[model samples]
Target chain A: MNAEDAGANLAREADESHGRTVAAERRALVQALILVLLTLWTFRDEVTKSVAQASTMTQAAHGLALPALAVMLLYCRRAELSRDLQKGSWWGAVLIILAVLAYAVTTWPFYVSYVRKLQFVTAFAGIALVVGGWRILWRCGPLLVLTGLAMPIGWNTYSTLSIRPETLTMDTALKALNLLPDMVVRLQGTELHYVHAGVQGVVGLGDAHNGLAAPLALASVYVFVTFSRVRPAWQSAILLIVAIPVVALGNLLRVLLHACLTVWSGAMPAEGLPRDVALVLSLVATYLVVAAASIVLDHLFVEEGGDSRVATTIRR
Target chain B: MESKDIVRTGAIRRLCSPIFGTTALILLVAAVALDPAMTALDIHFRKTSILPRVSLSAFDAATLPSFKSAPKESPFLDPHPDDDAGTRDHVLQRLQERDANGTDGQVILFVTYYSDPNDQVPHTPEVCYRQIGGVVRAIGSRTVELGQGDWPKRVEVRTVIVEQELANAAIAYVFCANGRFYTRRNEVRLALGWPGDKRVYFSKIEAVSRFERDEQPDLAMARACKLLSEVLPALLTRHFPRQADLKHRAVGAAR
Candidate 1:
């Protein structure tokens, strides 16, 4: 054959090969989507209950936005997922079996609401592994972790986890409130009682405000680490580690703000718009502080192959 | 085709294999089967009788003459509006002494009965009081003698002093599960979760009393204990089911 004809033949073969790869990826994507929907259908009751609680309960409010955040993260990492997709493993089947058995046990013989809710995430992970293999699971690990954290926790669990942070926030707020002119502050467990300018009020740092900032801050930091292009392993670790105290500081600031509002307004709005606004402000402030820290860390460290890590089209 | 393309094609082919398809089918079937299985088990368990002979609503505070029912607006009692009706029957009442000189003598009575073994043990004052912004200090358990003729002559109750900003109160509570009295929540869980007991139930009897600034803390504890002794005997006789009745119901249920 002449060189021109040979070149044309090669180009046609390459086009067909590319077409086949694209078709295969599209089929796999469709299959994965179906598996995810089936997993959701399997755990519909848990999902409904979680959504209800997330909508109504202040502590679980973060849960309402978590699935969306996870979906956003997955969408952003679509190219990475396509690049990482591989053969399914038998281990995933084993994981699915174990997760299903756990769901059954928690459902029937012993009704553990927490573990049952957790099975939704576990089953999703198993499906990911079964459909897209380990590389895809690893690629989507942060989103899965975020999804797991989004599960609605029981009050008992919330109280147990929040007690220390609540105590710290209250104690710090008490000291700060006492600094004000003619302000006498007394902390009774989670309640902050203050007498300022002859107006008596009690600001309760109840379960609603307990250590909430920390998890929120941590979740925000995780999202930052996942989305930011320059995050090395150490930098992500630093951001996560720094989030705890930043959240504590944010919680302290929130309580102080709420207390001042209560004292000045002569009204203690515990669970209404005022408290919600304060909580949101605190979370935003915490995120800002973490973001600042991330920027500082970026400046401090020299990331290797930073340009190469940027998003690239998947080529087979 | 390039080797990378070949590898990608092979991986995708493996993912679409019949083995993975069967696994997916099994998962889908399991998901579909779970709800019905859970419902069947619930039905089977509900058939085993586990209710009190007389409901907690039968409790008549008029039997105790010194205490009168206080209004709902009374700040002494914790209004637990989130009590689950499916697994728990909760009754809370604030009682004031008609002849008492001050608010120090007022008593808050809380009673809750649980028929579901799967539910967590009832919240103790240590946790509940703390949740409501009370600093709880545990004072060891003591036996409160009930002079009334019953299977048990006395019951052991745990006491805690809850210090709030505006008020200092004392709380005393006991858990009765399956004809056994327990001073701790874990003990109550053990009693309720014990095998072979088809008719399982537990009730928490809690009494709370506030004391004035100058009044002794012991006085508040004594007031709560006094109200508890009066209420316990009446509850056993009127509200809670007897052991014989429970056994008979269980036998009938089994048949």
Candidate 2:
């Protein structure tokens, strides 16, 4: 064969190989599309059913609120591609598959345990998918955590935070109030009475829930308001840290105020400014104060780069 | 295909299935791990005027459903427009109205009529109290006011001399405010001091729970026993009159 002819033949073969590669890629694209569509359609019922079930766990006011926030966040960030988009993990798929097994077990409706198992599996797997597996697809881990809000599953503040030194806080609050000026302050027999007054409240019962949601929420707002103008990351991280206790402290204050009022007034809490009204008023006040405090904090602490800590680190 | 395309191709579909799938699994595991806590609260089957009228419970499922599926407000619970709001500001105001400025030893038995909302039968108790020196305030807890002041308050407790014949049936409920529910620590009287013989079910309260238990065929005891309890009320009342009714005919003879 002539040299020119040989070169022409080689070029043709190269073209053929390139065409084959493109064809193979087209096939892969079609398959992936089909897989995505089918997965959503097939599991659509389960996804919705799971979310619906989760929504029930939240208080009536907040049942749908979390999901709404999730959607709004995505809308706000639509311009940016998420980091953890669609890398399928075996762990994630295993979760839904358990439902299939759970569903089979549930065939015997007479078996109460199996029914409960079905419910539990559905909730647990669905949540893990959203939190952990979804994290595989997203940049924001905090938002992923927020998804748990779909079901406002909460535990008693005491149960969750009991190990965090409630006794010390109670003593501090009482000491600040000048409640124990004379008698030695000691928690006895799991119950403490103001031996002088014979009035008893659990010394270590420093929980955020016992009708102090408003105050706690307010205190949290204070921390955030105190630090708002700080850099987004710093503000978020600091506010996040500050929010829980701000709310807890706010709650403690409300409780202390109520206990004091009850002892002094000799009237029922429901009667004095009324418990319900006090709760509402305190909640509103807390929001206002927290917002004001955050603004003040932002002005006082937020420097050029971020908050004082971030600035100080940069300075070094 | 390029690597980015490869990641994108499988990504979104891979994302949703497992995230939700696993969350559900974990929640299920947690639910399984948690012990079932069934509390008997809510008033439906039997009649008792002592409890507050708010029947639409925020708590769901496990407690028995109000026997009537159709929502009708109880006449008792319906807030009275005619009632003075200023007078109603305090729980004590309501308490005083209930007590009618009384004096001396009297007791009121607040018993649990039905607790399980899933209970098929029509027995719902406002609160459950066993009559052996026992007074149930709501459910899972009860309090007897020994009156304000001093150590080792002398609270009125019912003591039984004989079964079925109530010696201290005449009583009134003590007014308690703002519930404080704590975790059952060693504080829940974890001590197994004695056999539960001193405890006896209140006659009326027992009747309600029995009615509920009987509805479930599996739990139904074919044979039932009469409610046998005794009490020592702080104050005596005319409503649950002492030795007036023939039901207590056994009182003098048994003595």
Candidate 3:
């Protein structure tokens, strides 16, 4: 063949090869979708119970949004997933079997309420491994962790763990509220007594007020860490480490806002639309703070790249 | 066929291979179906092993000699609200007494009976007090001696002092699960959840007394403890399920 003819033939072959890889990736994704659906269907009851708890319990309300956030995180990485898709391994089947058996034991012989909820996450991971292989599982690790965190903290567990944070939140809120001119806020135990403009009211900082902000803040941090492409596990660790005080500050802000509204209105709206709105606003503020910190970190630590000036100078 | 058609057909055939596709579907279906089947099995297990207990409604609070049933209105104390009716039975009472010091001592008695094995550990004074805007200052367990002929000669009860903005409360409570007394919440959970004897039941008897700034918690604690000792024996004998009945049920299920 002439040179022109040979070149055209080679280009045609490359097109065919590219077509085959794309087709294979598409098929694998469809299969993975089917597996995910099956896993979710199987664990529908647990998910429903979790959703109900998240809706009613203030401490777990953030759980209602986590699943959707996880899906969004996965969606953001679609390009990476499509590029790295491959045939799965038999080990995924082993994981699926182990998770199913553990779920059965928890369900029939002994009812471990919390552990049974966790099996939903394990089954999802196993499904991901089965359909998209190890690379996909690695890529989707943060989303999986997010899904696990989405499970509602059981009432017993929340009651046990919330005491210290609750006390700290109350104390910080009291301090902040007192800073307002013409507002004298006093905390006696969990109740906050406020006086402003000759108006007096008492806001009882119950379970509803104390625990929701921290978990909501932590969930928001994970969302940021997942979406912002924060690198080097240590950086993510720092973000997580700073999240505690951020959560405390957010909770203090929520209490101060709620207490102010209660004092001004001459009624204690401890739990209702006003309190919920204040909580959502505080969470929004928390997210903005976290986003600003993440951006600062991004600027402070630059990732070394092949085209970087420093790398180019070293090569020269 | 053209080469392109051949490649497309080959890909479809590989993707839809019957053996591999069928096995994957079967495995997933089995995993999906496992929970409901096992939950059915659990229902069967619960049906056979559940013990019969006298309902809390049958226990008349007025029958006690030293205490009379007063109105259930307390500023600092309220019953822990539970939405799931099927899981537990709750009764709240305000008991009143005129102490020897001429001070009218009032105690709020809250009792709950749980039979559902899936139910979590019952809320304790530590959690309940906090829910009502009270901070728990101190919590510990104390042994209270019951009168003669009581099934348990001595019982350990959790004692907590809670401080609210408007008032302060001294509280004491104990859990009777599987015919034994327990002070801690986890102990009660373990006893009720033990698979050895599946006849699971637990009752929490809690008493709270509100004291002012002038009075110490000792007075409030003494009043609560006094009420607990007077009422605990009656509940064990008259209200709770007997150990003999549980064994009989087990034997019948075994047969």
Question: Which candidate ranks first by DockQ, i.e. highest?
Answer: 3
lDDT (tens digit, per residue) of candidate 2 on B60-127: 11121111111232221212112221222111111111222231111122222121222221111211
Q: What DockQ do the predictions score, one after another?
A: 0.26, 0.04, 0.27
Against the unseen true structure, what C-alpha lDDT does each candidate score? 0.70, 0.33, 0.70
Interface RMSD of each: 3.2, 15.2, 3.6
Report clash pairs, candidate 1.
Answer: none
Q: Report fnat, model 1.
A: 0.37
Docking class of 2: incorrect
* Alpha carbon deviation, residue B191, candidate 2 (Å): 20
Q: Candidate 3 docking: what grade?
A: acceptable
Name the regions of candidate 1 deviating beyond 4 angstroms.
A1-25, A204-230, A265-268, A303-316, B1-15, B47-121, B131-133, B136-161, B166-195, B205-255
Name the better of 1 and 3 by TM-score: 3
Docking class of predicted structure 1? acceptable
Model 1 per-residue lDDT tens digits across residues A37-105: 877777788878999988887667777777567667777766667777787776777777887888877
Q: In angstroms, how far off is A115's CA in candidate 3?
A: 3.8
Candidate 3 lDDT, A166-270, residue by residue in tens: 776777778878888898877665678777867777885556334554555456654555354525555577887887777777777887777776776666546
Two-chain complex of model 2, DockQ on C-alpha atoms against the true structure: 0.04
lDDT of 1 by residue, B174-252 (tens): 9988777898765665465454455777888888888754657888898788888888888888777777655534554
